[model samples]
Target chain A: DTAVSQTPKYLVTQMGNDKSIKCEQNLGHDTMYWYKQDSKKFLKIMFSYNNKELIINETVPNRFSPKSPDKAHLNLHINSLELGDSAVYFCASSQRSAAEAFFGQGTRLTVV
Target chain B: QQPVQSPQAVILREGEDAVINCSSSKALYSVHWYRQKHGEAPVFLMILLKGGEQKGHEKISASFNEKKQQSSLYLTASQLSYSGTYFCGTVRQAGTALIFGKGTTLSVSS
Candidate 1:
């Protein structure tokens, strides 16, 4: 079984459209994160939830909202996607107080 | 804040060795190393905590220097499978999110 999994491995949407990506982890971890990797491969943390509570939220736009229904799931919803929104999004999970994290395969989002 | 990685790219022949360094401007509580291949997720390689600590897994090893706020990943006996982009993540404090570096690309060829 995959430890961390996200739906819609590939997504292509038109500008001004709204889309969502779902993520789930069975590692029984306390923390789950969303990271965005650009074409240059620079990984940046977007949001993080610990035990279903928002912990760290970077300087992302309000159009991006993260909802964690439970400890095992973290979903990202983007509103009015822009051309610059095209990038690969990754879901990651890690145990509390641990330094290492496990990442999902990634969801490639392309906005026209 | 993102950590800085030296030698943005490197190429080595099989059996050769290479070292990738990561430095942080802020004090770091821990440093983690991960490798990602094309079209694949980043795989955890190792983590180092505390000053003067060294850890290794397989032929890959890493060292942490708290004083300089730096970490170095040593890839010994390079293999073709080792060709990938290596990233260093820094933890400023416990229970915080990881801040990753720009990444160092390593290509090992025969």
Candidate 2:
């Protein structure tokens, strides 16, 4: 079974369009995170949810919102996407905070 | 804060070895190593706790220096399959998020 999975592995959308990426993990983990990898391959943490509670929220734009419906699912919604939003988004889950994380296949978002 | 990685990229031939370093400004509780291939998810390699312990995984090993808040990943007898981008993730304290470095690209040729 896939430990962590993200839907819409590849997403190409136009500017000002809104989209959402769904993520789910079956690793029975309590902590989940969303990371963004830019063209430079710099992985930056965007948000984190522990047991469905927000724990870490980076300085991301207001247009980007993360919703965790349960401990197993965390989805990212982007509003009025910009060119800068084009990158690979990865969903990860860990047994606990600061522990080793298991990553998903990643969703590549392309904005034109 | 994000850790700084040295030697942004490296090229090696089969049987050669290389080392990548990661340094953090704040005191670290632990350091994790991951390797990612082109268009693939990052795979966890190993983790080094704050005790300055060294951990090994097959031909790959890592050392952590608690005093300096630094960690180094060592790859020995590199194989073509070892070619990937190495990333170092650090945790400042318990129950905190893991911050990652920019990653070092390692290209191993036959």
Candidate 3:
């Protein structure tokens, strides 16, 4: 079974559009995180949820929001997507006791 | 904060040794190392926690210097398959999010 999976491996939409990316993990993890990898290959954490509680919220714009429906799923929704938002979005999960994270294949969202 | 990685790119021959370093401005509780191939997601290498920290799964070795706010990954007897982009992630405290470096690209030639 897949440890972690993300929907719409590739997404393309125009600016000002709204889009959502869904993620689910088979592993019984208590924490889930959202990371953005820029074109330069630099990765940064956007938001983190542990046991459905917000733990970390970086300097991400208000246009981006993350929601955890349950411990196994975390979804990211972007309002009025901008060109700068075009990057690979990765959803990761890990146990509260473990420092290592298991990442999804990644969703490449291209704002055209 | 973002960790800084030195030697943006490196070329090494098989059986040789190479070192990848990661430094943070803030004190760290642990450091995580991972390698990513050209088009694949990163694979975990090892984790170094605080002082007296050193871990390795294979010929790859890593050390964390809490006081110095730095960590280094050493690959001894490098193999051809050891070629990939190495990244260092720093965790300032327990349950904190990881801040990654720009990544160091290593190319091991035959």
Candidate 4:
């Protein structure tokens, strides 16, 4: 079984459209995170949830919201997407906040 | 704060050795190493917690200097499979999110 998994490996949408990416971890980890990798390959943390509680929220735009319905599931929703939103979004989980993280295959988002 | 990585990129041949360094200005409680191949997720390499401990692998090793808040990843006997971008994630405390470095690109060819 995949330790971490994300749906919609590839997504292409028009500008102003809203979309969502779902993430799940079967490792029974307590902490989950969402990271965005730009074209330059710079990985930036967007949000993090610990035990279904919000713990870290970077300077991300309001259009991006993260929902953690349960400890094993975290989902990202983007509203009115822009061209800048085109990037690879990754979902990761760790046993604890500071432990090594396992990342999902990634969801490639393209805004045209 | 984000950690600074040295040698933005490196090219090495099989059997050659390379070293990638990661340093932070603030005090760190632990350092995590990961390697990401093109179009793939980042894979964990190792983790070095406080106490300035050193961990070794069959061909890769890493050292941590808590006082200086620095860590170095040593790759010996480089293999083509080692070609990827190496990232170092640092945590200031146990419950904080891991902050990653810009990453160092490594290319190992036979």
Model 4 lDDT per residue over A1-112, tens place: 9999999999999999999999999999999999999998889999989999999899999999999888999999999999999999999999997788999999999999
**DockQ, all models:** 0.76, 0.82, 0.60, 0.84
Kindly indicate the candidate among 2 and 3 with the higher DockQ.
2
Candidate 2 chain B: minimum summed lDDT over ten consecutive residues — where? B90-99
Q: What TM-score against the true fold does each predicted structure earn? A: 0.98, 0.99, 0.96, 0.99
Q: What is the lDDT of candidate 1?
A: 0.93
Q: Which stretches of model 1 miss by more than 4 angstroms? A: none
Model 1 / residue A17 / CA error / Å:
0.4
User: On residues B21-74, what C-alpha lDDT tens digit does candidate 3 reach at each position?
Assistant: 899899888889989887667787888888758888789999888888989999
Interface RMSD, in order shown? 1.2, 0.9, 1.7, 0.7
Candidate 4 per-residue lDDT over residues B1-110, each given as its tens digit = 88999989999999999999999999999999999999999999999999999998779999999999999999999999999999999999989998899999999888
> How accurate locally is residue B30 in candidate 3, as Cα lDDT from 0 to 100?
83
Worst 10 residues of 2 chain A by lDDT: A92-101
In model 1, the Cα lDDT at residue A30 comes to 95
List model 4's recovered fraction of native interface contacts, to 2 decimals. Answer: 0.73
Cα displacement (angstroms), candidate 1, residue B55, comes to 0.5
Candidate 2: misplaced stretches above 4 Å? Answer: none
